[model samples]
Target: MDFSALNKSAANSFNQQKSLIKKVLAGKKVKCNNCNTLISVHTGADSVMIKCEKDCTDIKLDAELLK
Candidate 1:
């Protein structure tokens, strides 16, 4: 195995996670619908997936429905 390559891959993964965390911190947040758990949100994203509490169900939110 190429240790250097593995380290580089890990570093890249770390950077991506760090960036996502920073983005989450900088973005808006709302409570999870079912559990009321606070979750970060990225409104402008294309939204591949938005989940709360790792591996848990995703909460769907609609402004109209909230009203």
Candidate 2:
């Protein structure tokens, strides 16, 4: 079975997610898929976090994405 295509697809998805995260970091509004509420992105000295007011979606991004 070919894995290159799968790898490429994964890479593309990752890039898209990173792009979205960057937009959030820049103060763009993003919504939570589960709760359909505004997502709040917070950046710290060493990490980035995203969450909704309802707490349905919470994710702590790797610090490397800050670049």
Candidate 3:
């Protein structure tokens, strides 16, 4: 199997995902530290889960960061 092609495909997917996420967050909202996507707000006990939209990676952000 050609690993180069696989790597290139993965890289292209990553780049596309990154660009899409960046375009969505171009308004300058708070970003998650783990995956670098815009932060999300949930309605529950915690009320907030900072996950990257592309990868769903979790990030621990401080409340003060919202300010």
Q: Please tell me which predicted candidate would have the highest lDDT against the true structure.
A: 2
For model 1, how does the per-residue alpha-carbon lDDT over 37-60 read when each residue is reduced to its tens digit? Answer: 665543433333345664243433
lDDT per residue (tens digit) for residues 6-45 in model 3: 9998787776546544543354465555567665543234
Candidate 3 global lDDT: 0.53
lDDT of 2 by residue, 2-24 (tens): 79999988787777666766667
Distance from true location, Cα of 15 in model 3, Å: 2.7
Clashing pairs in 1: none
Model 2, residue 44: distance off in Å is 2.9
RMSD (Cα, Å) of model 1? 13.5
List ranges where model 2 is wrong by over 4 Å. 1-19
Model 3 clashes, total count: 0
TM-score of each: 0.30, 0.55, 0.28
Q: Pick the candidate with the highest TM-score.
A: 2
lDDT of 1: 0.52
